[model samples]
Target: MANTPQSKKRARQNERRYAVNKARRSRIRTYLRKVEEAIAAGDKDAAAVALRAAQPELMRGVTKGVMHKNTVSRKLSRLSARVKALG
Candidate 1:
């Protein structure tokens, strides 16, 4: 219940961070969806472009602590492979 002042402050901070992280995660997902949509549409060029655009956003998620480094790396590798296979 956050009886202590410090605890209350921490709870507030957590809420703000949660909102920011949620937005970042959503943005990353949107980028990933763009890549997926392009891939599903069978446009290699578009998929490549979408993957390229998504890479940095995914890395940003790692740096921002919204996602793990290895997770992002694996996602990038798999997505890149699929995009390559499209050719």
Candidate 2:
């Protein structure tokens, strides 16, 4: 569909970026899931440790443009609250 060379290049770049972003998103989700599972298990110490591990990954997602800052902020806040409540 891209007739122009520039458009073709742009399409290729988009594909590459898409793959990278997808991987980043998946990685972030994995980190978040770990925290969720810890929380669900009601292991306060484990949940706290998981949250700490996830914090940097979530922030990395925001920095990489894979996720919005406020979204990450809200997630962190809620997860921290739940972890706190678990104890």
Candidate 3:
């Protein structure tokens, strides 16, 4: 119940931000899924490439406040390790 004008504006802003963040999150997941699929298919080169592409997107999400820095770091670390282990 945002009765105040300021509160109503804030609610609208929140909705817009939520939609944008949701899209960003979905985009990130799509990138991650590409890497995962590559890994699952045993394509080390493709997985490595996908991981490389995904790194910046994930970091950007962190910078945009859509994701936590450590969360992205841990994900990148784990994914990198797994990619490295792929032979």
* Model 3: residues with Cα > 4 Å off, grouped in runs: none
Ranking by TM-score: 1, 3, 2
Ranked candidates, highest lDDT first? 3, 1, 2
Candidate 1 local lDDT, 1-87, one digit each (tens): 999999999999999999999999999999999999999999999999999999999999999999999999999999999999998
Native-vs-model 1 lDDT?
A: 0.97
Q: List the residue pairs that clash in candidate 1.
A: none
Q: Write the per-residue lDDT of candidate 3 for residues 1-87, one digit (tens) a residue.
A: 999999999999999999999999999999999999999999999999999999999999999999999999999999999999998
lDDT of 2 by residue, 1-87 (tens): 998999999999999999999999999999899999999998999999999999999999989999999999999999999999996
* Candidate whose TM-score is highest: 1
**What's the C-alpha lDDT at position 81 in model 1?**
96
The per-model lDDT (C-alpha) reads 0.97, 0.95, 0.98
Q: How does each model score on TM-score?
A: 0.99, 0.98, 0.98
Model 1 residue runs over 4 Å out of place are none
| RMSD in Å for model 2 | 0.5
Task: Give me the displacement of residue 13 in model 2, in angstroms.
Answer: 0.3
Give candidate 2 misplaced runs (Cα > 4 Å).
Answer: none
